[model samples]
Target: MNAIADEAIYSFGIDIGGTFTDVILHRGSDGQSISTKVLTTHLDPREGAIIGVRQLLEQWPIPPRQVGRVVHATTLFTNALIERKGVPTALVTTAGFADSLEIGTERKFDLYDINIEKPAPLVPRELRFEVEERLNARGEVVTALSQETLAAVVARLVEQRIESVAVVFLHSYLNPVHERLAAEYIRKHAPGVHVTTSYDVAPEIREYERTSTTTACAFVKPLAEGYLRGLQNNLRELNIGAPMFLMLSNGGLTHLEEVLKNPIQMLESGPAAGALSSAFFGKLDGYPDLLGFDMGGTTAKLCLVEQGAPMLAYAFEAGRTKRFMEGSGLPIKISTVELIEIGAGGGSIARANSLGLLNVGPDSAGSEPGPVCYGRGGDQPTVTDANLQLGYLNPDFFAGGSMQIDAPLAGHAIGRLADQLGLSLVKAASGIHILVSEAMASAARVHIAEHGRDPRHYSLLLTGGGGPVHGYCVGRKLGVKRLICPPSPGVASAWGLLVAPVKIDRVRTLQTTVQDGDLQAVEQSFLELEQEARGVVQESAVQHQKTFVKRLAEGRYKGQGFSLIVPVPDAALGNEQGRQALIEAFENEYRRKFSRAPSNLKIELVAIRLSVHTEDLIEEGLQFPSRSGALAAVKQVRKAWFEETGGYVDTTVYNRDLLGSGDTFNGPALVEDAGSTLVVGPNATCSVTAHGSIIIELH
Candidate 1:
């Protein structure tokens, strides 16, 4: 097939991770591209963003004025919460429940830990005040709100000079009237303070989860709002008039205004973008079932994609006391892609435990000190240092040689670890790599099993900085037959931002079994949610853009503790046959998830959900010009550690920018690119695809 560059419409995507800021420029003509990664400016991530953007434009010879809309994603909000650096906020809860945030259902993640610590409550107990109000599950007021008590609570909040407040009442999800009125009074009395209500934030049944979600929204609202506003102003200053949209953890884009009111929805935004990109690429390549593997500088994220869609979870725990524990941190009841993440990225620090066992990280050196190989004052060994010592990376050519790696230092770092472990340096380095791969594969297995799926059935699509470098070994460990690394694996998250759909998610709580037969109420709730979604998508629309809305429901069998999400078509919800059809779909989904549905029980619909989306398709005719002939191996052959071989073996190194489609290479080889490197281990072979990607098949 001839190269197709004509469809390249120039667009940009920016993703700011914990350790780096990645920028990508996609040229419409021939799919010519530019990608860059800059050290994150933790003081102000925007500084690194600007630098990355400029570097990409300069490298591609593209002027900033001609650029189209820039899709941006970031982990800033997530990091702020995890690091406990968010704004100080207060809480105003229903009477006798001022300690809701602190109590947290009294569930300990570690059942028997003598000294296990829970994440500290975001709002101090002193700042949390009790207000008199009560609502039953049926949305009936059991006790009238005491105005004097509310006023007194407001007086206390004012005295404390609280900057933000969260209003969570008993059973407010069933009836939001009390919450609405309290919010209004707070705004009127405590002028200049931010307020969020559980009904508006997360209209779910669980009081603890709903209250925590609302509190987090209030806690981060000021910081996220101010940061986004600053970013918007910076973009406007650069003459980038295109509508600014922030990527959501749900794999959609939301307006800046919406996010300012609900910043909790932005957690996992950066990693979610990478998962979306991998799913999008999988669809384009006709792979329906695949694994989206994204490894950046600080963490590796793995998500399962089935039928071209990523799995969604309604609740997620952040800043957990235990890594994989169910109830350790703040709970957010929001729609988000289900993914497993671990501290196994390139910069994961290598250390000796107190017991003298070698351990890789849950902590990282980050971009500042980086790895010992980076020669940036990092004396500690890291995953990058391991890769460098094993000869998987080219020291002088790392990051296109813009930054050189200190091989001698890497050797020294591994050497120390080896001495401690009673092993040779190469064995220690390779062991670290193998251990990391096993950790990733193990996590992926657990995540897949949780969803009632087998991990062995899916293909692994590896992306991000360390993913491709270590993908082969990881894939082998997981029994994956094929691994695909795209043209720019390191910047996959940036690519995902550009390809995401403009959308909004709206939901309404309607907790009732079919015996209540409130079908009309159900339909009405969906209609209201649809209207809210339409308003959001309409604002996101551009000229001539068509809009589409879809309906869904959170449902379960009566008496079931949990629910399964099922899509509801408008046609079905609009008519009797359609309603029955949706019921069948729900039953099938329940069976798929739980082996079987209880035929004796009625179906309970928990929430009416809807999403209005406007799809922006990338032009189809874009193609990059072909580089003629097979890529020549530029560097002399070297002995690199191959874990499978149990020793150092001869390996070949080639420049990726010069590689032509259809060229083939074997394992124990390195394909070096400007932005990242692809390592092919022993017993594997890679072929350059028509799209300039390296497809590796394991034996």
Candidate 2:
């Protein structure tokens, strides 16, 4: 294939997930988009991504030179930490703080459990070395860094063949001079070793969180560098001369260099992109406030989107021993889209527990073996197998007929679990399906309630490979009346990467009372943060594109250990009016959360944050293309099981591509698309929107 017209340009978005690699292409000449999905290559994720990209471009026949931009998001770093596949790393901390990771805030996620297991530290004790350096809370040096001790630590690290090191000095967020000096010495002596400092990764007051965040960055630094550079080189070799932008956990995009420095920032990159995609499609479909339900092969994630933006969180846990427990995972302080994730997906393993109760999963078969229906050597019963057994999935139409699925194999796999549970095949399959739906609904309820939102008020927008398949039952459980399945729901995350803005978030610790404090210093600190954030954004921003900045402050009452984030006033904070505005904002937010504010308590500002991002590049109200033919919508009829219908009933199956705008259909129908399938329950009214989205309305 030859290159398109020189004037026309194209952009590619690639998302490497746990089970699949999604690649999407968008043309600048027209609002055309296409996507493809391939099984993830667990050995080297880059290989799967490259293959998907090559296949997409070949199918669409777009030349490489015309590709102007490449945006990517991946779960590689997160998986590395979870699987302990990262290189050997070391930690250098101030004296007497070597056990900080072991003694993490002295808080237990489950207090009543006699034997609670905590996430282990990435670096073992032998790999953790301490140096003689100290700084007080006021940023004053208490004990100077011992040069001989630091040199010896560096020598020990080199001797141990540590490829990466995390240097976290006490109070380094306030005074990083000692940490910087140690890093400089290490780089000079062992130039091959990578160094990460707490101040650079997470400059906050919490000792344990800062150290954990830095250690995570260091642990994945070498692996991230190699994979990213190799992917870039391979793209160039394909004659695609575009600059690649990486997706950040905070629902933004950054340059390769920025993420290589702190790979932890990409920990939630894939899920964040999925959330952003939901928000983007929801707004276009006239539902700005909705809940994003993304159920891929490995897990299900739910995020709250309000006013066309998904909520942002400052910190999130990674590699949790307990999926829903907060402190059961490593605490990493990085900005990310707020969401709750549960282990309920198509590939989630299903089995009878010791108590003779059926349990779905926190474990998935992934794409390597996949579900039994894929004929990938999988012997375990999974949600996909159960769905197939229930007639919810068309074996021949799986993955748009790109791959053949064996229905008998799926039934045989589920038959074992059915026998153990002493239930019929159909009954057992229904149990598995309902169990996963209930789990997702339970998690979503808590997540929404935590944000003081009512599930009935928010429309549920479903995406990912499994979302549409299970969305109806999940939404019904949550008492949600409406659900939306956007076009190409399976590869939405890749499309999200293309629309994400170039963003940078910066923070600084500034302890001060709203009533009496150094206002000038606070203002100066914000200015500095904004300047730094904007500089980073410019590295990835388009030439001459306008940028926007949002100022936020983390504040708390006088004696509180936790803080809440509130928007800071746009006016100058050096004046009394600005201070009053800040206080009012904090109080307003407090009232919303707690229903009232204390009358006689002082407000303390813990930190200030600045976020800079380029303006949205995609136009609003853009609609996806519809089918060009007048072909009949109903492709076939299949006997499908539905609780509402009691037993197997002949259900009309419709091809999603043939359903044009305003096409209306009733329940007990299956809308089949190339990427995913949407199941409409009995009595529910399904309609096609102008943009090719399937909207199911249930009373």
Candidate 3:
């Protein structure tokens, strides 16, 4: 059949990681789930994705048209920025302020360091031309944009042969007349070049972030669009004519058309999926606070989840030279799920530095060369090699025996590292393991401290292939006593896409003082904002189950440098009581933040935010019945290294599929699955939950 018009309802979620292409196919009618992990084709991620989807569909017996939806997350744009591989882009801004991206906030993330490096601007100085126009903070055009000014800018762009152009006039977030005029002119004059404006991409406060975000969007617009269109056409050719969706960095799904125009929103889309999975699973288990730990082949991401919601921030940085510090990269004024990522994963390379000291990564081998054990022509020692040498991995059972790992090659690689360190192979392997663990802990500590969260109150949920292998040590360093490992943790990120809702978040700057501002004006502004946001959602062709809206305001003292978000009740905000209620809400939130609120200071409302989204598009169904099979066939013993014991130990190894509900055991133990391994550290107790996940208690 060319199409299955009356077939069962099924959906697919795809995530492209550095080393693997993870796919999760699920039946919406009954919650049947099938997952697969295949090595990533770095040259063309779509090649690996098609293979995985084809294999999954063949095995699960789902019809092509029965796959109603496909949600995707990829690292293409982020990697392009880091590697400086985007299209040739130019920037056009207000004449006097064209260099705002370089000026930044002028505050060094490391104040005492004299030689801190910042990533070069996406639009270099020579290519950043300026139009002679000005707009005051209130959006008043001081010097109205003229035709002559537009013509000159277009001439320069055409002469330089810029592939794309970004227009970022000052105060465009408040009013966009000038920016729109400039963008329209460039579009008409430069027929073949693409255009992006700050008003369309990031209509928010802060000039530097807006410019940076717009520039980034312009830089990747051409390349990302071509890649996505190629994949979409390929899928259509396969008789899978489903509407494709792309994941946003805010843990929501939007149509591919939206992402192609605003590529900056996809910078952290892959990592955000893991955080969303964390929040969903945490809510199901009655956990209000948790720490998400996800380590794949290239990196480890840590996010703080509170009250079933992952933390969110408007300001984000990408491609940082200093991984732990801010202000070392380009700032994007886009709302997104907040998380910290570091280079500490299975494929992280190990090297002896010029100082002759052992150094683990901030660099990864990725999928092309992978690790020494993968036998993919890699000669360098990596974390995977260390794990194999320490007996944490099984050589023959890797990738469910589909791919074989060479243990001898791994040992040889580790032996070279051991020789340089002047230590035994096991000792060097232990050092590599511990150093990466410490690096992960350092990233988590900085991330949590910045968010003002205490680690003792949060349990660590380990996802990704590399997370559980190092979770015990990292958790202990962060004072986390409880760890939860979900079933098929490595594929959780992809599964998150199947549950994501179609969402659109919009923000507009409206500077108003609470003491003297009109409540009627506040009520009117929010209504306009809600309508605008709703229009965007309604434009999409996807049919949502339910729809709703949430109104929020960013508030702070008149002289404060930062602002806090507070919820506003729609009905109460139209009268005197609503104004009173808003002030009280601000006071309550302020006291919660600073332990007290100043009664004398004036509270100024900075911005209005609107979040419009559909209700849970998919039903909650991660739970699975415990298996009734015997464990004797899957149970075995292996030699595993344990730092607590200061040597190798006989660790019990069990198959994850054979462990049923109510099954309990004590570590040292290793639980194997098709795609990942869960390590139960010494002195910990593990139990299988009703959902077939593992819960470990160290105290």
Candidate 4:
């Protein structure tokens, strides 16, 4: 394949993580890129973006107008939901059906626990108003919507003074006639208030998921829209004329208009960006299957990527009161990259429990006061503090030495917790390290197991500030043989946004028996939906120059509650032979997933989902230095603890900037750069790749 480059297009990517705000500026002409990381301003996330952009400008003198594209991904919306900071929302649904959000399937994910907890509904009972409306399973109106019912609902909404309203009627996915009427009336009467409908957010089969998705969109609409608009205005004020875009949870980049209509799509976009980076960079070296790991300040995420594509899931829980408990969180229906997240990171607090056992965390010190070593008024010991106490982190060179770590303060905090556990300082620090690593490994096991995957078959792709620090130990525990560390690991998420495609996802419910249904009509349905999706692409200014359309449908046994995606060929529905091929394809996929297909059950097609993507974004000819195994790269030798050795070892510290392609080094060693530090275990060997990445082969 030939390389493609937009010689005139210069792009900038911005990603705001809990601990850092990363910015990257790239010139398409030469494939040269420079990135910078600044401390995140949590009080106002926008301020962090501004500060990072300015810092990068100081280092690379590029005019703002010359930058053609600006893409951003952040954790702001997800944090808002977790912190219970959303706009006042009201739910308007079919009469007597307002409880679906609260009565989700009534199946406890944890059957034996008596004190199971679920997230409270976004809209309370007093704010949920019902109207007379009904639709059959066939999209036919059973009880026609009345003008009086709309009038009464609108009156109640105005009286409540709610900031946003979610309208979801019974069988709305099959037919949205009543929902449309209610929304139209609300917009006219309750002007200036945000309105979202179930069919617009999630047009699916399940009522509980559809209603919850609609409510979540409403809950965050006001907050996300206001923040985005204000940020755009600020960019304009700074004379940056580039078209700005936002990242979506599905690992695509879309304009602000689409995200404003459905804010729930951006909830997990931050982690999705990091996963995309591994998929994109891993392919450059011919690795197809990867265990993408990103450990930041407050959380660690692991995703499975096969052949440069991340696995996508349609449903997941958010804001779980219990960590890793499925049913305890709010169910959201949106296309998102499948990743498992745990509260194990650099900022995870370390303390002795009442039983005198040391626990790493489900809590974090965050970036406000930060870890004890940050010397930002944090009194509690965190993973970072423990790492510092163990000499894995350099007190004189933390954050490129811009912020000096308080080594003494960090010791005092860890020492205090060590006394409670009746252990020495070194043992206490090592216990914290092992405990957090085990937690990450356990989460990865569960995530890989759910997909019937073996962790031994995948190589760990590490990114984020804390990723390289913990990757070696975690991969060893999982019995993985290899780990790859990329350049600027902490800013990899921002880098992912630079190479992401502009995509839009669309869905239509078509519950029918494939054998009995008219195949031509099914083929015709995809074309119609493709047209609608094209309308959205047309509105985007950055993409649609060259586009691609993929078609897939969800299929299941007649009585099943779940479904699997089956690819439908372009010519599959036009003829009898092609139609049989379609059935065979579905059956093969079903058997592969479940190991068997029921002989007595018939097959049913549930829905058709379409994805429209812009032309694949390509970046090639990124120049790197030739191979060199020179001794000048080594900066110093410091005494660092190696748990495998049972004590401290003299570790060689290397300056990453001085390392070249094909360079090889033996551990234990520290590879330090401005953005992050890579720790090589004594049992592993590190080699620099042609792409300027370090590959560690663990024995």
**TM-score to native of every candidate shown:** 0.94, 0.97, 0.96, 0.97
- Highest lDDT against the true fold, candidate: 2
**What is the C-alpha lDDT profile of model 4 across 145-222, one tens digit per residue?**
878877898888888788999999888898787888888889999998899999999999888888988898899999
Per-residue lDDT tens digits for candidate 1, residues 1-699, read 111122325777889987778988887655566788888888999988888776776677755556656678989888888888877688888888888777888877888998989888888888888888898889899988889989999998888888889999999888889889999999999998899998888987888888888888888888888888888777677665555677888888766777787888888789889988888777766776899999988999999999987877778988887788878777888878889888888999887789978888889988888888888899889998898888888887777677777799889999999999888888789888988888898888888878778767888998888988888888888898888887778888998887787778877888766544667778788778878887776665544466788788888888778788888755645467666777788888888776887777888888877878776546253354565544464455777878777788888877777778888878878777766777788788888777667778888
lDDT of each: 0.81, 0.89, 0.84, 0.85
Tell me the tens digit of each residue's lDDT in model 2 across 1-699: 111123337889999988888998888777788788889999989999999889888888877988878899999999899888888989999999999999999998999988999999999999999999889999999999999999999889888889999999998888889989989999999889999999999999999999999999999999999999999998998999788889999999988888888889999999999999999889888999999999999989999999999999999888998887889999999999999988788899999999888999979999989999899999999999988887778888887787889989889989999999998988889999999999999999999988888999999999998999899999999999899999899898987897788899998998999889887899999889988888888778777778999999999999999999999988789999998999899999999988999989999989999899986555442347766432487889888888787789988898888888888888888888878889888969988888878889996
Candidate 3 deviant stretches above 4 angstroms: 1-8, 538-544, 621-623, 629-633
What TM-score would candidate 2 get against the native? 0.97
Clashes of each: 14, 0, 0, 0
Residue-by-residue lDDT tens digits, candidate 3, 307-360: 987888777888888876778888887778899898888999998998888999
Ranking by TM-score: 2, 4, 3, 1
CA RMSD, predictions in order? 3.5, 2.4, 2.4, 2.4
Query: Model 1: what TM-score?
Result: 0.94
Indicate whether candidate 1 or candidate 4 has the larger TM-score.
4
Task: Give Cα distance to truth, residue 610, candidate 1, Å.
Answer: 1.6
Could you tell me which residue pairs clash in candidate 4?
none
Q: Which wins on lDDT, candidate 1 or candidate 2? A: 2
Q: Flag regions of model 4 displaced more than 4 Å.
A: 1-5, 538-545, 621-630
